[model samples]
Target: MKLVPLGDRVVLKQVEAEETTASGIVLPGQAQEKPQQAEVIAVGPGGIVNGKEVKMEVEVGNTVIYSKYAGTEVKMDGTDYIIVKQEDILAVIK
Candidate 1:
């Protein structure tokens, strides 16, 4: 099975949190923070949404930064994914 977003929705895969800090201190799983970075897996086609023209600026495989608490989490086929709105995406990494 695959995930396909609709309207202005975007699907992303969260980047893994770092196990160790810059100071070289290893952190436990419970101490790790939620990652704000993600990679685009699937994108919805641009279309009218809420009476506004929604154009998709991001594409598949695009690495992006998003709001901390932006998307809904889901597990599909043992793979994790996040479903968010295009607006929730802050910027695409070059």
Candidate 2:
């Protein structure tokens, strides 16, 4: 399924946390944290501001770093997804 975010919102397909360390230390399933990193798959058009449209800072295809528990959880075609406002987004990771 494909989705487009409404004004100033974005949809991120989460990148999962690695379960093992480089040194070969394995992490328990429950012990692993959800990765706050994500690939920006879809973006909303610029949001309205002061009666004028404000362009969004993040764009589709940008990788971003967000709060660990920032977005609303959603599921699409068996894949987990997150929806967040552009204002809630912290930074676009390099």
Candidate 3:
């Protein structure tokens, strides 16, 4: 499915948390919390800020960290993705 953000919003696919512990031991799904890291699947063209248009600092394929409780869950072609604003994006990972 194609995603076109309306404004300064972004659509992200949730990245799964570690399936194993730091010691290389595998952990069950019940042991993990919802992963807050996400991949930038799509982004808006820009948004209106002040009297000018402010473009998004993010792009597709960027891995970023965002607020855990932010964004809305959406399903596209049976895949889950989150929709959030740029303001909620904390940082971009290397």
Candidate 4:
């Protein structure tokens, strides 16, 4: 099954966290922090939202950084994804 966002929602697949520290010490899975970076999988068409006109600034294949506690988590066919509003996305990684 595939995810198709509606309104101003965006679908993202998070980039895996680093398993090793900069010093080369391998950290266990539990010690790794969830990365805020994610690749844009799908984007909702921009339109009127809450009395304001919204425009989508990101696109598929773009890497973005989102708020730490933003978005809803979903699992499909063993793949994890996050669905969030466009406003929840902080910045696009160039």
The per-residue C-alpha lDDT of model 3 at residue 88 equals 84
lDDT tens digits by residue: candidate 3, 7-45: 888999977766565743232333333336789999987
How do the predictions measure up, each by TM-score?
Answer: 0.79, 0.71, 0.75, 0.79
* Clash count (model 4, backbone only): 0
Indicate the residue-level lDDT of 73 in model 3.
87
lDDT of 2 by residue, 31-88 (tens): 3343367788898886685566868888888878765455798898998888987766
Candidate 1 C-alpha lDDT tens digits along 1-94: 9999989999999777565657432323333343377889999996998899999999999988776465799999999999999988888878
- Give candidate 4 misplaced runs (Cα > 4 Å): 19-35
Model 1 residue 33 CA deviation (Å) reads 12
What are the per-model numbers of colliding residue pairs?
0, 0, 0, 0
Residue pairs with backbone atoms closer than 3 Å in model 2 (clashes): none
For model 2, state the Cα shift of residue 28 in Å: 16
The residue pairs found clashing in candidate 1 are none
Candidate 2 segments whose C-alpha is farther than 4 A from its true place = 19-35, 49-52, 68-70
